[model samples]
Target: MGVHGHAVGVDFGTSTSLVAARAGRLPVEVVPLGRTTRSFPSIAGFRGEQLLVGEDTDDLSGDAVIRSAKRAITQNLETLSVAGRRIPADEVITALLAEIGRRAEAVDQPLSMARDLRLGCPAMWDGAQRQRLLGLAEKAGFPIDETTLVDEPIAAGIAWVMNRSLFYGERLEGRLLVFDMGGGTLDIAVLDVLSDGPGTEPEISVLSALGAELAGDKLDQAIAGDLTSDLAAQGHSSSSARRPELFTALVLRAARDAKIALSQRAEHRIMLPSRQLGQLPMLTYTREKLEEAFRPQMDIAEALVWAALRASRLTVRDNRSAADLRVLTPEALRGDVDYVLLAGGMSRIPYVERRLGALFPGAQVFDNAGVQPDEAIVAGLADTISYRRLNLHRPGFDFIIEWEEGGQLRQEILYPAHTPFYSPQQVLSGQSDLGFARHDRDFPGPRSGSGRLRVRSTSGEYLGLAVDNQTMDGLVVRFGNRMDFKLYCDGRILIRDGSGRALHMRVDRWPVIRGRDSGRLQLRSAVDREPIVPTGWYMDKEYAPPIR
Candidate 1:
């Protein structure tokens, strides 16, 4: 195959995209298209009946180009218009993935035969959206079975940890926070990087994490609005413009450029045509004024960082006695944060680092050394995949138990993330309320019975959250005689309910894990079952099951 056996890491970012993997001793190179870097602008353009994707699509026409496709996932979108032509998001994604495969195959000859991939997406994607993306991947000839979906924050975290040397430290320790300001989203995560243990692989654990959809584009729009206002003051309006979309597009583009310039310079200038601004004027913007306009967006981002910290179990300190909690708890540490990491392209903003540094002066914050702040996520993706591959060859990390409290009985999750690919299937056991069944049409499904069980991963290394934190922490309840659901870090599940007590199952028997000697076991046995499943908020159950 190609270098290191063909596995690829796909960073499907909101603003830009990239694919990388371990090629050899040297780091994985970005799959380039002739002269560009590893990243491709995340955009798609439609012309007549054909679709143009990535960088070339970005150049087609601002009106035709669709940037930040990931943001559209959370919206209600059936079709997108490009030059009055309607196209589905799936079609756009299919075009992009096909282009990704084409460019990758051009560089790695082994990848020519390899259709399998490890794709990364935003953590905010829900169940339906994730399935839609998977469907798109399959329609483009890359099947879901051949791919593994990782969240962007998780992949970024992995990349950050692997490239730890770049941060200048004697192997990191204590709670570190990652303030990832990317194109379409802002994610904050808290981690505890432990010293290399005598018997374990150097471990990093997530203590807390959270994210907001607001990102660079929002700031761009904010500044663009300010710029537009200035132009309007000079008499530019949609009624007078030849093409309002074109004018708005130019203003937005200029806003993005100005934002980037402010990351380095104290002041910058923006030029506009006299015709666009009532014939008497050219427009100029200083970096200070732009930052002033964008301050609201930055405030939201800062709040999200502190909110993530408050969401952690670490925040639940023992209210009574200090001896009741672990010595390493934040309270024990006198509310001190130990480490702070910076990932994603937008993180390079000088103000971001400066503000975060002021918040936790005792903690160390990491920023990559490169001209393009945006390339770090993809580069980190490459480094993460490589390091995980290496760990697969060494002694793996230990697993911890996941326990949830119930009013009566406790529920438990026996397995956690990062369990080696070759590890045997793990098991979970818990007792549920064997209560009465009512013939109720109000049930979300046709099933007759319901039982809810809460489970959490106790794995030391999760994809998105810091090490030691469970990204897949939630409840799995089956009702109408049967209950089933698949859990994930993305917080999306495929559930099914059937006849009774246990509505539907992958296998017909208990102790259901089958060996290779048995006929192929049911894939859906783990979670997938029925359709028309209702999506809603599930309360985190924290009950401990009583010992029988």
Candidate 2:
């Protein structure tokens, strides 16, 4: 899809970005950038009239640079100031993507660059954020139709599946918990893998998924806060805190390095490299001090894991603690977990690995060998054509409708947030299709505009409405009426009579779509981007035949 060649995986991180590409029968390789390195810092800046990315941001040493474009986009900021004038966040992110594309195409073999891209996103980002990011990438010049956005943790899990040595050759089975604590987000995925006989690849199924904003970047911020107090204790910086840019750069760099260093050694020293403030005294941090600063962060991480496990219907024992992470009792290891694939640089921390390991009694915890944690995600994302086709987009909003059936009233999930819909069900061995929920069946015509449906927010706030198109008012339901029910993938509900006519609602055009059928097939972001074709509209091979 590119003018020259093709690129498969693009791991857009908060603190860095990586790209991987492959040609026919070629091994997947990370594109070299920034002094022949595979990963580049995700820093962008506007110098003069030009936008700068990758190694170019090194010139912004004393100046203010757009630190985290990913975070800004996640917060839905319209524009960010580069130097002085405000530039749109979309333009900034696009610049980064464009730079990556250019670098990827400049490989030794000179990749022509395919238009199709596999973008890795945080598991917690909902449809709104996902759409907004996709729009930004499209504006940056990639083909939107060919691009496939996937959850970061799932990508890591796939990477683990591709390379199973991390399991210590124990023949991994049961629930494989993937805890990805990266620079900007913490994602948790529980997968069920089953092997079939000898030499055949296993099947991976998603059991449940959860994520939070808590991650390594948050720990850096917490460490930076602690540094401010340390400065107060030093008695030198208690006065000269004027140069904010210098302070911000110095603190962040020190925090990141100190966090990594403290993971292995008991003590680490941080030196302030601020030219404006001149050379300052080196700050020494012991493991005890680091633990003190990281306690709150670890508590938050524990809570996220707790919630993710509960969502997956897994229970934990009472002795789950990082400070006292010992061997799990035989009872504790019962039916809980088998292995945990720990991804991201943050997951390498002794506290994180041990703490997460404590939650799963008999599970083996694996992490980056050396500097490979940051490089692992992009490779998994670039494994093959299969990675690009894997789409497990669960709904974000909870939809429930009150209906009368068999002379009694009942309410259940018309569309559950955790249930993925209408994909190539043949890809999986055993899974239900959405065919039952959507069908044109033989039945009698409707008696009236009588179905009563109330849509509400997850917190019980009334937001969705069942409109009657007849008089342009709320729908009124009459008992014993036959109607067709459709739960759209984009969280829309439609009800029609046996004659295939919509009823029980009256309304003008919905937010960013046209016509009923078109609206049901389109998904809109929270920030309102250009409308895109819905994934649920059925692509080629929308159903896959399970391999026997």
Instruction: Encode model 1's per-residue lDDT on 221-336: one tens digit a residue.
Output: 88899888887897876557777776777678788888888887887678754454335355677767866876787777765555455433322322321123222343334255
Candidate 2 per-residue C-alpha lDDT over 1-548 given as tens digits, one digit per residue, 9 for 90 to 100:
11223447788898888877644323457787656567877888867777888788776753557867887656778887655568788877888877776776666522234544678888767556776787777767665531366678877877776566222333445777788888888787776665553333445656456676777878887887787778768765625767765676668768888898998899998878746667677888777777777788777666555444433431122223221222333254335667788888787678877777776667677785222667667766665533322323243334444555567766544444333343221112223222115333322223442445444333334343322212222234443334445543223344544333443121221121111322132222222332233232232244632111
Which segments of candidate 2 are over 4 A away from where they belong?
1-7, 22-27, 81-86, 108-112, 165-172, 314-334, 368-371, 385-548
- Give the Cα error of residue 322 in candidate 1, in Å: 19
Model 1 worst lDDT window (10 residues): 422-431
Q: Per-prediction count of colliding residue pairs?
A: 34, 20
Best-performing candidate as measured by lDDT: 2
